[model samples]
Target: MSLYRPHKKGTTPSGYRGTVVARERDFTAPTVQLLNPAGVLRPTPEAEPYLPLVEALPDTTLEQFYRDMAISRRIDIAGANLQRQGQLALWVPSHGQEAAQVGSARAARAQDHIFPSYREHIVGMIRGLDPVNILSLLRGATLGGWNPAENGNFHLYTLVLASQTLHATGYAMGIQFDGSVGTGDPETDAAVLVYYGDGSTSQGDANEALVFASSYQTPQVFFIQNNQWAISVPVSRQSRSPLSLRGSGFGMPGVRIDGNDVLVSYAVTRQSLEEARSGAGPSLIEAVTYRMGAHTTADDPTKYRTDAEVAYWAERDPITRYRTWLEGRGASPAFFDEVDAEAADVAADLRRRALSLTAPTREKIFAHVYSEPHPLMAEELAWLDAYESGFEGGAA
Candidate 1:
């Protein structure tokens, strides 16, 4: 017998008992949280074990985590500048969600695969992708900077919202098939972490992925960075409730962490990933944060959002809060200066690479369009060659 109790002993609830069953189109979900806006740690009973892990990390490590967020923010800003200067076609900024990306990225094991949305450039850096290569892709010089398999399992950024969730699920299924999980070996048991935004929660692909993950018990974590505004649309317009409850509907535990709190984000993601790798199936993390800057260079958030709302979130800047916490712990001023200098150096190098990038040759674009050359491709290539040869300068 099922453990669930009926809403009524022998009849439906009063509101629906005598009426036809009408499907209500609206429902609200609750946001699960382990930390508050303040820097104080406040973990739930279920999340208590993870607290020790966070506390065990040394002060130096915590400072370095802050540095990662700062450096990444600098890179994001520089990329936006590049776009404005016509060095890039477009640029997506992760200005406010740095803690969410860096904390989770640092928590990932070397064997873990990360499927990310386009805003996860910081995560790419954590996975060993050079910042300049990522800039090159944005500048239209390459499809992507590094191969997925070579970059410590960091996959290419998915431009389509929520599509990478299914890819991550499928990859986790392969991991399960290969018996790469549940061997009690942290070094070998692989897990997958997929990143998305709150706006993507409404996508059919995201919901379907949750269904498949629950049914198959894949070792994956769905990391949703709820940055409040989905481009110009406020999250309230998309759903009345929090996004974490979506995981509960699919029969997996859901937790929310302060995405702005690096400590909480790292601790919770680390714990959830470990659980999944140990055969705990999939989990969902709804990270509560804000996007302080425009979604992209092409977007003007001022049209859709109030200046007051933007100012409010600015006061709670993730990098600033972490720096404050580090200062309280006696971090040296020299260390901060060193990190700032290093970030400047990285940004300068990226700018140089972006300006010097050469466009790929015409032939290079067609070379990988197919695995094996087809008759149609041959004919198209011949036509292009003949057409180009008609010009004063023939095809190179």
Candidate 2:
């Protein structure tokens, strides 16, 4: 039996489960969308100033955007398959989020820092991180595989849910302390971009981070990829209104955009990050997208969602829509074929690296518990060794 079916009218007080939350009124908050699901480009008044920016982007760069989305989907599939094959301890699929992540990541400058909430593989990919680096984490080979300071300022993936918002806010404040903002030097000034899900909007840490960000006027953009479902809890349960409205309450401007459309995602993010970098305080973005796959390798989304809903989103597939737009723009079949071949090569390489990863040794867990060793850590380590040595022929 399907675990999640829509409720009937008058079945509940709010007509949606038994809660008396905000009623679903007229959907007045306009969503910025440049490309429709039919693969046609339609101009929007809110997105006007940014359309020229998209046009000014070189054709090579535009083509690369599509390539990034295609390749990231390949990598996402590889990760999920590797988990099923027991190569990875866990997998967080980014199957349907490539456009939202890739578009925004590309919009940020190289000098800007980024904070990712575990599932942003494409964002990390754009910021000079090899997909293998993330595989090491999911495969239980390392706590963190790459150095954030040296690797294009992409911070380590924070899995604690919404905690990265505080970290991002603090980092943005540090940038301010270091005189990195309002210097009239775009190259030297730095901004921060942090990614989180719609579910996180309800978390205290995320709200607190926004409060701090607003108070300090931090140079940061809070990118919330509202993937509709937060691990089986629909976004409807999280907020009564659009998630972007939360920003206005915190004294920052907010924007809601169609996350599946790469054009809107890229254009909106560029504008928001520019405002932050110019010392105009923080901004919030709610990118309306969907997670086509399960929340994780362990999740069975079929239990909580209907196949019909999934099919509806599949019809609005970001990659498919973008590919259609590209074809209309005369992107040759040869280029598309080449991109497919490149994605296959990337997937193959990732599989090889994922299989080659070695599990971390038990002793390695004690390496970074603290800056200096403590008596408790020493006692635990010694006790662990003694217990393991009791086995026949075990290393002392």
lDDT on C-alpha atoms for all candidate structures: 0.85, 0.91
Off-target runs (Cα >4 Å) in candidate 1 are 1-48
Q: In candidate 2, which residue pairs get closer than 3 Å at backbone N, Cα or C atoms, i.e. clash?
A: none
For 1-396, candidate 2 gives per-residue lDDT tens digits of 986777687575345555567866854567888888989888677777778778888889889999999999998889989999988889998888888998999999999999999999888889998889899998888888889987889999988889999999999999988989888898988899999999998999999999999999999999999999999999999998899899898999999998998988998899898888888889999999999998999999989999999999999999999999999999999999999999999999989977887777777878778888788888888899999899999779
Structural similarity to truth (TM-score) of each candidate: 0.90, 0.91
RMSD of every prediction: 6.3, 7.5
In candidate 1, position 78 carries an lDDT of 86
* Candidate 1, residue 67: how far the Cα is off, in Å: 1.5
Task: Report residue 13 deviation for candidate 2 (angstroms).
Answer: 25
Q: State model 1's lDDT.
A: 0.85
lDDT of 1 by residue, 1-396 (tens): 986656864466443556456888676543333444554456656557667888889877788798899889889878999999999988999999998999899999999999999999989988988777777778887786678898889998888899999999999999988999999998999999999999998999999999999999999999999999889888887667677777899999887777887877898899889989999999999988998888889999889889898888888788887877677678889889999999888888888888888887667666767899778777887788789889997863
Model 2 CA lDDT for position 272: 90
